[model samples]
Target: MRILISLCLALGGLLSLPAFALSDSGQQALGQLQTRWAEIRYELPEKQREAAFAGLAKEADQALASEPKAAELLIWRGIILSTWAGAKGGLGALDLVKQARASLEQALAMDPKALDGSAYTSLGSLYYQVPGWPIGFGDDEKAEAMLKQALALNPKGIDPNYFYGDYLLRQKRYAEARAALETALQAPDRPGRELADKGRREEARALLAEVRKKLE
Candidate 1:
């Protein structure tokens, strides 16, 4: 259950970037991918998520076939792959995560600022969440740097702040975690993202409650 929720980390809401290169059909494809991802992550039952995410990943892959150079599409593909890996947790999922990391890295190289720096946010979350050393590629130092870069790009974005706060909480940095979650709560509502904003605020509030318990 925790993994399910954590998988949603670092996914920015309703792209705020202009995404100048995507055509009308590409934009529509992106929207479908986003809508489907949100539905699978937030609305689907936990037991059913693995299959759902697998399906979505295939859909995203098919979309990418046409718009291979679209950075935003690549980001969504990475996001879907990450969530799918979470849903299918175990050694078998490592390949999916690796693919996700590679896709996000490619997206970053193509457009670091795309989707409001979501590539950085997602990549950062992966760094902290995956196991380190021989088991996986996780590294706390790299996580912090990537997350901070994401925050620098979108200072007031809810997703970046929430992810940063979550990472801080994992490090037992309660005060900093609380501050970041508070900022997430205070983040402005993004246009066309009412559902994501509301859901994220609730998550921030839940984490804030946990952080307050630590402070107490």
Candidate 2:
């Protein structure tokens, strides 16, 4: 269950950059992707969400095509593809996860600090969420390294804190996980992300409650 939750990290709204600062087309692309992300995470039924995310993946591809070297665009595209892979599920989604990883790697190469280090967050989540053997390329060590870098880059961002907390929880580092989640709960809200912020805060609260119980 926790793995499933972690796979849907896109719902946490990792893109912390203000939309107003983006180019008009970039803003529009992000807006569209976020809307589809919300629909996949909240509104759509489990069976239908995969198709919804597939459509969003196409949109993300178009955005990346227009701004091939834009780190911001690459980050968003990675987010979309990651969410799409989560929705698709099973071994069939392996390719999508790989694509997401590649997109994030490109974004990192172009600008590791773009969108508040969101590419690292997303890539780290993918590394931990996918299978580790013949099935996929997951690596807990790599995930931890990447997530720590993300947190270092964006210590106060809700997404990084929550993700690191989730990673710690999965590793049974309950005390550290609880602390990270608590920090995530205290993160300030972004101007245009009220819905995403509210949703993520609720998730953090719930996870923190679970960690508290475990610590007890």
Candidate 3:
């Protein structure tokens, strides 16, 4: 009788070990995914970005399934889909964009303040990148508002700073763009910061050179 009892307890413990290991592994995987996502954000080429995003999407889906209530996984999934849309182009892009939007919405609903306002930053970029008007998608005003909110949440976050600078540059507000870009370039360990800094400085110099030409 005692032998049987011992055997049952061992079996139960063995079964429980897998569950505990899986839970810990899932958390670790999620952390690695976030770090990889950040590192790849600026390194990926336009063509390669789609493939990378697809991989990220797959990993995120697996993580979400394993931990259904993980809001961070949802946010990562949304970011991957959104980036994929940008890479793919055409009507298919629109579909991915919609998916991305929904995923981010789900993330926000799960946790309004997940990952330092990352969801808001994603939405802001979506609005800024998509076309405006009858074609549907894109809203510069909305983009500005969302990005501002993200900044409010994470005043020194790299993404909001870089994107906001790009927005200003598009408006040809040279001085403002320069200021914002400078701040973005200075942001700690921001992916592609050095490259972006070089690009922005070159742009500023060229713009100033043009002004000089005109004055001359």
| TM-score winner | 1
Q: What does the lDDT come to for candidate 2? A: 0.80
TM-score of each: 0.93, 0.90, 0.71
Candidate 3 lDDT tens digits, 144-179:
898787678766555566666666666666666566
Model 2 TM-score is 0.90
Per-model CA lDDT versus the true structure? 0.85, 0.80, 0.60
Put down candidate 2 lDDT per residue, 30-86, tens digits, no spaces. Answer: 777776676677767888978888888888888877767777777778887787778
lDDT of 2 at 211: 96
Better of 1 and 3 by TM-score: 1
Which sections of candidate 2 miss by over 4 Å?
A: 1-6, 11-22
**Best lDDT among the predictions, by candidate number:** 1
Off-target runs (Cα >4 Å) in candidate 1 are: 1-5, 13-20
CA RMSD (A), model 1:
2.5
Better of 1 and 3 by lDDT: 1
Question: Model 1 residue 164 lDDT?
Answer: 95
Give the clashing pairs for model 3: none
